[model samples]
Target: MKVLVLGGDGYCGWPTSLHLSDAGHEVVIVDNCVRRQIDHELATQSLTPITDMKQRVKAWQEVSGQTIAVEFGDLLDWEFISDVVRRHQPDAIVHFAEQRAAPYSMIDRRHAVYTQHNNVVGNLNVLFAIQEFVPECHLVKLGTMGEYGQPNIDIEEGYIEIEHNGRKDVLPYPKQPGSWYHLSKVHDSHNIAFACRIWGMRATDLNQGVVYGTVTPQTERDPRLINRFDYEEVFGTVLNRFCIQAAIGHPLTVYGKGGQIRGFLDIRDTVRCIELAVENPAEFGEFRVFNQFTEEFSVNQLAEMVVEAAGKLGFEARIDNIPNPRVEKEEHYYNAKRTKLLDLGLQPHYLGDSLLDSLLNIALEYRDRIDPDVVMPSVDWREGRAKQRVHKAPAQPSASL
Candidate 1:
């Protein structure tokens, strides 16, 4: 399959692009380097030293001997996306280009609008590009499980069966998005569903969980092929944050009671899930949704796992229950159905099995790069910036390293 990967330079996008290319698909990466720019804006870098885009592609080609074409342009540019679609006529297009951090989105009003404009408009352009040039091309969009928030009941993949007034109908599941970033995803999902219904477009919205790990088969081939491992307050997931703290002997700052639960998966499984979705394209006029996660754990559970994982490497890490900056349900029941990809032969990488090799060891290797200041929560859900930044455990001295 000829595959077009939007946002192919990002954390998930870069690895997925390589995986597709290694799987014998002709892959083209479309990105504007906005993620790198954001790193600069935030005065933070990935825990792993990632090479530039050109060097990354060069190293991958040298390692895998597979050529992946790259185009530098924003998705908001209709001409660029439309031309790419017309030129490649790819069998599938994996959409991963968006501002993905919830904390980043909740930073302020400007950031909020930017997140929506970038994510929603970019997705709309992709839909239109497909509609105009390659109607048969499957759009595999990266949606978030956060779009559903934490409902009292079980979360379906994307839609739910409802019987109202003695009539049975399946409707798009009700969204209670917690942040502006998630709201953007919700908007994109609705837009994709609309396009499919109105124009017979095919799309798969993969509502992915919190992806952990910094390595994949393709990324492990070369150092330059290493993917981004964000451990900052804004972009870092809970698992990444905890592992980084453990690496530097910083206390694992668990926000609130640490009862917040969400689904998670390894970086390897994330790429495989993409391939599975691409191989099994959704039908025309059908917008399929797959809850793409292998395991579920609360924030406290994740911290505990990280502590144990770090202990195996001779690191002692303690948990610090901090005030929850984000206005979310600290404790909620979350059981989301995720059988679609499993039925499609998704062999999941469980957290318990791969934590040491996938995350903790990487954190220890890059212990020198761990910025202690950025490990704490800075963005408040209600007021954007918190009244006071909390840093209970300062990073251990570099001399100790």
Candidate 2:
């Protein structure tokens, strides 16, 4: 199958591109390299040194003998996306190109507007290009679990069957998106579903959870092919941040009650899930949704796991109960259904002590590169309030376990 991975230079996109190529699919990656520019704007870089697109593609070819074609352009540009789609005429286009940080979206009014504009416009352009160029192309859009935002009721996959006044109807799941970034995703879902209904386009919206860990089978082939590991407050997931804190002897910063439960999956499983979605596409005129996560964990539970894992490595990690910056439920009912991917032959890589240990080891190796400044919460969810910045203290020696 010919596949095009948008945002192919990103943390997840890079490895997924290589994985797809390695699996004998003709792969083409389209990216604007805006993520690298964001790293520059934020003054923070990935914990793992990432290669440029040419270098990354070259490394993958050297390691796996599979070539991945690359195209550089902004997804919002209709001409660029349409040209790529027309040229490639791919069977599937995996969309991961977006400004994906919740905190970044909440940083300021300017950022919020930018996040919404960039993400929403980019997605709309992709849909238009697909419609214009390749009507049969399957769009595997990367939606977020955050779109469903901790509703009290058990979350269904994409849609819910509700009966009201002797009438039964199925509708897309109710969205309670927390941040502008997530709101953009919710908008994308509506647009995609509408397109499918009206234009007979096919799409799969993978409502993915918080992804952790770094290396994948294809990325592990070469040092240059390594995926990005972000441990900063804005971009990092809780588990990844915890592991990095443990590595550098910083206290595991738990926000508020630290009982915010969320679904999670390893990086390896993320790529596998994408593969499953690519292989089994949605029927024409159908917009399928899959909850793409293996398991669930709260912020406190993740901090505890990191502490225990660090203990085995002779680090007595401590937990700090910091005030929650985001206006979200610290504790909430979160029962999300995620059986679709599993049924589609997804063998999950569950979170374990060994996995945490391995991540900690990577952090330790890159410990010197960590900026210490980027490790804590800086963006406040509250509007019109001053941004609170926490600086990472010097790493203390591990106490005797």
Root-mean-square deviation (CA) per prediction: 5.9, 6.5
Off-target runs (Cα >4 Å) in candidate 1 are 385-401
Model 1, global lDDT? 0.89
Candidate 2: lDDT over CA atoms? 0.89
Lowest summed lDDT window (length 10), candidate 1: 392-401
Instruction: Report lDDT per candidate.
Output: 0.89, 0.89
lDDT of 1 by residue, 103-207 (tens): 888876667777888899999999999999899999999999999999999999998999999999999999999999999999999999999999999999999
Residue 114, model 2: Cα distance from true site in angstroms: 0.9
- Candidate 2 local lDDT, 1-401, one digit each (tens): 99999999998898899889988999999998988877766778899999899999999888888899999998877888899999999999999999999987887766767777778989999999889999999999999999999999999999999999999999889999999899999999999999999999999999999999999888888888889999898888888898888888889999999999999999999999999999999999999999999999999999998888888999799999998989999989999999999999999997887888898899899999888888888788886232545222111101210
